[model samples]
Target: MCGIVTAIATNNVVPVLLEGLRKLEYRGYDSAGLAVLAGELTRLRSCGRVAELAALADARQLSAHIGIAHTRWATHGVPSERNAHPHISGGLAVVHNGIIENFESIKADLQGKGYVFESETDTEAIAHLVHYKLQANTDLFEAVRQATNELVGAYAIGVVAEADPFRVIVARRGSPLLLGIGEDGMYAASDTAALLQVTRKIVYLEDGDLAELRRDSYIVIRSDGSPVEREVHISSLSADAVELGKFRHYMQKEIFEQPQALAQTLELIAGGAGITPQHFGARAGEVFDGVRRVLVLACGTSYHAGLVARYWIESIAKLPVTVEIASEYRYRESVPDPDTLVVVISQSGETADTLAALKHAKALGMQRTLAICNVPESAIVRETALRFITRAGPEIGVASTKAFTTQLAAFALLTLALAKINGRLSAEDEERRLAALRHLPVAVQKVLELEPEIEQWAQRFAGKEHALFLGRGSHWPIAMEGALKLKEISYIHAEAYAAGELKHGPLALVDKDMPVIAVSPADELLEKLKSNLQEVRARGGELYVFADAGSEIPESEGVHILHMPEHYGMLSPVLHVIPLQLLSYHAALVKGTDVDKPRNLAKSVTVE
Candidate 1:
C-alpha cells in the first residue's frame, strides 16, 4: 500500500502536502518524496519517513502552488532515493499507488522510443507513457487519460506537467482516489484522513474516471471521453480522531481505545434494544430470507474475523458457513450457489484481494452479497447491496486492535439477526443477548485494566525468538490472532494451534526456550484445555496463560497465570484478544522495534 496527496492551491502548498503525507503515514511506507511545479518540475526525495522528506524540503526551501507527494511502500523496486515516487520524465512528474502489471512491455516500448528511465519502478513506465502522450496533445488531462488506456493493472495516479503548472491530473482504475473540494483550491488523495484538514467535502472517483484539478474548479471525465458528474459528499472523519493523544504510539493508543470503539460500534444495540435483520441494511431482510448457506471471504486479520464468524453462524443460525482466504479464493474454482449469502469483511473496505474475490463470487451468480466494513464511502461498500459500517474510528496502527474487536462485535450482531430471522432465537434469549452486548464496553474497560500485568508478562518475551499460542473452540481464532499480533509487531516467530493438536506435531517443538501462551476461558472446552497445558508442562515448556476468573490453573514453576477480570461467556473472544494485543505492544516496546510502522507491512493492502 502507498499514499498519494496532490494539491493545486492558490497559496504555497508545501505545508499542506507534508501534512497530508503525515496523515497518510499510518498506511505504511519506506520512502517519501514530492514534486512541486515551481515554474519547472522540481522534486525532492528521501529514503526514510515523511519527517526526513519534510526536513529535506525545509533545507532546500521547496515551495509551490501546485504539487504531488507520495509515501512509497516499494512494490516494484528497492527502498531508495531513486526508487521513491514523484518519478519524472520529460516535463511530466507522476506519483502512483497500486501496480502496473504490464510494465515490462511498456518499458521496453518506451525505451525503444528513446525514453530514458531513472528509477526501476512500474510507476516510471507511467511517467514515460504520459510524457509520450503529451507529445501528441498538450492537454494534461487528455494525455493522462490516453496513457492510462494502455495500462493493464490497478492504479491511482497524480500527474503534473510543467507545461500545465496550474493543473493536476488524477485518475483511478482499481485503487482508491478521491477529490477534495477546498475553499481555495482542489485536492486529491488516497484516503479521507489525508484531506480532513483542508476540506470535508469529497468526491469519490470510480474506476476508469479521470479528473483535472485547478485552483478554483475541477472537471471529471469517463473512460469513453464523455463528461460525467460525480456527487460531492461530506466526509465524516475528524482530524482529532487520528491524533495520538497521551499515548506513546498509535498502536498503544488504538489498543486502549477499544472500549470506546466497541461502545460506538454497538451504539445501536447497546441501549438494550432488540436486534433485527434491518441492523445491517435496509435490504437485509430480503437477502437473509433466501440465503441457505454463508460464504465469508477476507484477507489477513479480516480473514481471521471470518473464521470466528463461521463458528457463530453455524451454531447459532444453523446455517453451514465457509470461510475462504480472499486472495486464494479469487484464483481457484469454487462452487457458488444463488441462495448463498457472501459476506466480505474488511476494515478499510478497499482491500484489493477481498474486493476482487467479491467480484469473482458475483460473477459466479452469488448475487446476494453483504460487506462488513468501516469506511462508508469505500468501493467494497458501494459494490455490495448491503453493508454494516463498523465505527472503530481511524485505525492508524499497522497492527490492528480496535478494528478487529469491532469487526467481531459486528459479526455477533449479524449472527443474532440471522438467528432471529430464522425463528431460532426466542424473545427472552434475544433480550439476554442484547443486554450482554450492551455490557461489552464496560467489560472491555475492565480488560484494559490488566495492561500493567500484561506488561510484566511481556518483559519475559523481550528476548524470545519464538512463541506458541493455544486455544480451544472459538478461542482457537483468538489464539491465531494473538500469534499474528506478536509476529507482526515484535518480529517474533509465532504460531497458533487448537489445543487438541499439540500431541500430533507441535508438542515436539515445545521446550523451555519456547513460551506457550494459552487462552484459558471458562467455556465447555476448559477441562480439555487444562489437559493440554499439562502436556506442555510435561515437555518442559514454559506457560503464559490468560485464564478466566477463578480458574483452577495454579501459578507454579513454569506456569504463569494472569486471570482475566471477568468471564464474558459468548463474547469472551473480544475480551481475550485485548491482553494479547497489549502483550505484543509492550514486547515490541521492550525490543525497541518500530511499533506503529512494522517492517515489510502496510496498514491497508491496496495492491495484490
Candidate 2:
C-alpha cells in the first residue's frame, strides 16, 4: 500500500503536502515524492522516508499553492528515486497507488507513439497515457478520466498540471481515497489521518468516482460523468493521539497504551451488570438473532486474535466458529451459510485480502456481517452491516500491539453479548464477566510492570538463532502471536506448536542451543504444559516459562521462569502478549534492527 495526499489551499501547499505525507507514512514508507505547480511543475522524488524527501524540498525552497504527494510501498518496481511516485510526463504529473494491471500493453502502445518511459513502474505508463489523452482534449480532468477508462485495475490517483496550475484531479477505483473540505482549502488523501490536522469533516470517495479540487471547493463526478454527492462524516481521531510524545518508538508507545486502549474499549460496560448485542451497534441485536454460526476473516496478527476469539465464541456462545486467513478464504471453494455471522477484523479497514474476503462472503448471500476495525470510515467498516471500532488510536508500528489487545477486548465483549442473547450466560455470570472486562485495564497494567524481567529474558533470546513457543488451550493462539512478534521484529527464526504436540515431532529439533518459551498459566492445561517443558529439558533444550505467580515452576539449571503477577483466567492472553511484545521490542532494540519500520513489512497490507 502507498499513500497519496493532495491539497489546494490559500497558503502555500508545500508544507501541507509534506505534513500529510508524514502523517500517512505508516501506510507506506519505501519512497516519497511530490509534484508542486509553482510557475511550472516542480517534481521532487526520493527513495526513502518522507523526512528525506521533505529535506530535499526544503533545500530547493519548493513552494506552491496547489500540489499532490505520495509516500510509496513499491509494487511494480524497486525502491529508487526513478521508481518513486509523482511520475511526470509532458505538462502533467501523476501519483498513484494500487496496480495498473495491463500496463505493459499500454506501455508498448505509448512507446509506439514515441513516448519513452523513465521508470520501470506501471505508473509511468499511466502518466504518458494521461499526457497523450490531454493532446486530444484540453481539459485536465477529462484527460484523467479518459486515462482511468484505459486502465484495468485498482488505483487512487492524483493528477496535477502545469498549464492548469490551480487544479487537481483525483480518481479512485477499488482503492481508498477521501476528500476533506475546509473553508480555506480542499484536500484529498488515501486516509483521513493525513487530513485531521486541517479538517475533521471528510467525504469518502466510492469506487469508480472522480473529483476536481481547487482552492475553495471541490466537485464530485461519478464514472458515467453525472454529478454526484457523497456523505460527509466527522472524524473522531485527534491530532494529538497519533503523535509519539516521549516514547522512543511507536511499538513501545503502543505497548504501553494498552491499558488506556482496554479502558476505552471496555468503558461502555464498566459498571454494568449485563450484556446485549446492542453493545456493538444499534442493529446488532437484530443481526445476532439471525446468526446461526460465525465465520471470522483476518490476516497476520489479526488472524491470531480471531483464533483466540474462536475459542471464546464456541465455548461461551455455544456456536460453532471458524477462522480463516483472509487471503486463502476467497480462493477456495467452500459452503457459505446465509445465516452465518461474517466477522472481519483489521486494524486498518483497508486491508485488501480481508476486504476481498468480506465481499466474497457477501456475494455468497451472507447478509449478517460485522467489522471489528480501528479506522472508522475505512472500506471494511463502510461495507459491513455492523461494526465495533477498537479505538486503539493510530498504530504506526508494522508489528501490531494495542490493536491486537483491543481486538481481543472487542471480541470478548462480542462473546459476552452472544452468550447473554443465547441464554448460555445467566445474569449473574454476565455481571461477573462484565466486572472482569472492566478490570482488564488494571490487569494488563499489572502485567506491563514485568518489563524489566522480560528484558532480561530478551537478552538471552536475542543471541539465539531459533526459538520455540509453546502453549495449550486458549493460550495456544497467544503462543502463536508471541512467536510471530519475535520473528517479525527481532528477525529470529521462531515457531509455535501446541504443547500437546511437542512429542509428536518437534522434540527432535530441541537441543541445548534452542530456547523453548512456554506459556504456563494456572489453567487446567498447565500440568500438561509442564510435562511438555520436561520433554524439552530432557532433550537438552533450554526452557523459558512465563508462568503464574505460584505455579510452582522454579528456575533451575536449564529452566528459566518469569512469573506473571497473577492469573487472568479467560483474559490471560491479553496480559500474556504484553511481555512477548516487550521481549520482541527489546530484542530488536538490542539487535540494532529497525524497530518501528521493519524491513519488508509495512503497517497495512493494502495490496494483494
Candidate 3:
C-alpha cells in the first residue's frame, strides 16, 4: 500500500515527481522520499509527507531530470526516515510498491557478498541487488532484469541511475503500474491520478512486463527483455473526475452522486446490448452447475460486498458460500475442490491481497474464477476467467462511496444470473427481480434527496465520540459498510451490529452520548428492527433512522427519521446506504477532518 512515481525527461523532474506524489498520497502516506539523478553523485531521501521531504531535499539542493519518488505505507519495517523509499545502492536508487516475500534470503545472500543495508525495508534489498548486478555489468536495464529474476513476490518497481541520467527502468510483477506518454516527458506511476496532470495517454503494465522510459520516448518489453509492442489506452477521466464539484468535499459529492452512479451501473448491466442474461446466466450456471461450495474473496469494502454476496448466494442460489478476507484467506489451510467457484471482488482490480488470494485459490486447483471489479482493464480483470465490471467511474475519495453502491448493484445482478443458471428463479420471478433492479436507480435518486436531512442529523451527532449502526438481514452488511465508511473517513469510533444482536452485547455500549443510527427499511425484518430500536431507546441511546417512507414506525418519540424511498426485497440495502454515506460525509465535514484523505489509510492496498 504505497505509491510510486517516476519521471524521465530532459527538463527538471523533481517538481513533477513531487506534484505526482501529492496527488498519489491517497495511496500511502506513512513516509515519503525521492531519489533524483542529480549531477553525478547526488541523491536525496527523507521521511514524512512529500511536502516535508521536499523541504529537506531542497536544503540538500538535489535536482535532476530523471528521478523516482515514493510515498510509503509501512509493511516490512517501521515508519522512519531511513526506512522511507527511493532506497540507494551505489549510484542506483529504486522506489518500489508491494512486498518482497523472499527478501530475508536475498538479504542474507547480499550480506554474505559484503553488501551493507542502510534500511530495514525489503525494498533496500532490490537496490543492493541492482548495485551488485551493475558492478558486473554497467547496463542498468540488463542489471534490473537480472536482479528482478532472482526476486520473488509482488512488486511494481521504478529505478533511476545517476550513470544513465536519461532513462528510468520500470517493471511490474503482481502490482499496478502505468506508463504515461507526455509531450514534455514520459512518466510512470502506480495509479492514473498521478499522471492525470500530465497526460491521459497511458499504457498499463501487465504482469511480467518492463518499461524503459526516456525524455522523448518509452518502450515496453517482456521480463526476458525482448521488445514488446504496447497499446495506449486513453483515460476517459476528466479533471472533473477528481473535483468536488458543488459539494463541500469529494466525499459529499460522491455521496450525492450515488443515485446517478447506481443508475449508470444498472443501465450498464441490464441495458447493455452485449450483456444478455443468457451470457451471464449460462456462464454462472455452468460454473456453479454442480458446485459443492462457493468461496468469495475480497479486501476492505469489497470484502463487505462479498459478505452481502454470501447472503445472496446462500439464499437464492441455494449454494453455500464462504466469504474470506483476502489478506487472511491464503494463510488458512482449507482447500476447495474443483467443483467450487471462487468469486473475487474489487473496485480498482489491483488490490494486492485480493490478487494474492486469487492466486492462492488457483494454486489449490480451483479453476473456476470470476472477478467483479470496476476498472475494466485492471490486473484482476485480466487474470480472471470471467469478469463483471462496475460502471462507478473513477472513485478518487479514499473511502469509497459510488464504488460500494455499484458493487452492490453488480452483486445483485450476479444473484439474478445465478438464479437463472440454476433454474431456481422462474421467468416471472426473474422479470420481477429485473424490474426491481431497473427501478433501483430511481430509488437511489430518491434516497439522495435525504442528504439535506442527513446533513442536519450529522450536525446533531457531530460532537458524539461514538456511534452504533444497526440493521438486519442483508442490511447487516450495509450497516457494517456504513460504520466502516464513518470510521474510515471521519475517524469516529463507529460500530455495526445486527439489530437482533444488540441485546447480546452491543446494547451495553448504548448511552445518550452515543448516537445509534439504525437502517430500518420496510422489509420482513422491519418489525424486528423496530423492536431493536426501542431497546436502544430504552437504554437512553439517541436514535436516528432512515426508514421506509410509509412505515408505521412512530415519527415522534424523539426519533429523527429520514424517509427512504420504496424498494423491493433485497434491493433496499442499495438505496438505504446513500443516507448513511451522506451522514458520514457530513459528519466528517462538520468535524473539519480531511474527508478525502483520512489519516493512516490508503485508497488502495498494494502491499501486504
Q: In terms of TM-score, how similar is model 2 to the real structure?
A: 0.97
**Reference-based TM-score, model 1:** 0.99
What's the CA error at residue 342 for candidate 2, in Å? 0.8
- The local distance difference test score of model 2 is 0.90
| Model 1 misplaced stretches (Cα beyond 4 Å) | none
lDDT per residue for candidate 2 within 1-608, as digits (tens), equals 78999999998889989999998876647899999988988899988788899899999988889999998887898889999989999978999989888999999999999998989999999899999999999999888888898898888999998999877999998788999987779999998889988998899998889999988878999877889999988887788877899999889999999999989877787666467788778999999995789999999999999999999999899999999999999999999899999999999998889999999999999989999999887889989999999888888888999999999999999998888788899878787788888988999998999999888888887688999999998899999999999998899999999999999999999999899998888988878888889999888999988998778988999998888988887888888888889989999988988888887887878778
Residue-level lDDT tens digits of model 1 in 289-386: 96899999998888889888888889899899999999999888788899999999999988999999999999999989999998998999998989
* Residues 10-34 of candidate 3: C-alpha lDDT, one tens digit per residue: 6788888888888887665788888
The C-alpha RMSD of each candidate to the native structure, in angstroms, is: 0.9, 1.5, 2.7
Local distance difference test values of all predictions, in order: 0.93, 0.90, 0.83
Q: For candidate 1, what is the lDDT?
A: 0.93
The candidate scoring highest on TM-score is 1
Off by over 4 Å in 2: none
Better of 2 and 3 by lDDT: 2
Structural similarity to truth (TM-score) of each candidate: 0.99, 0.97, 0.92
lDDT at position 85, candidate 1: 93
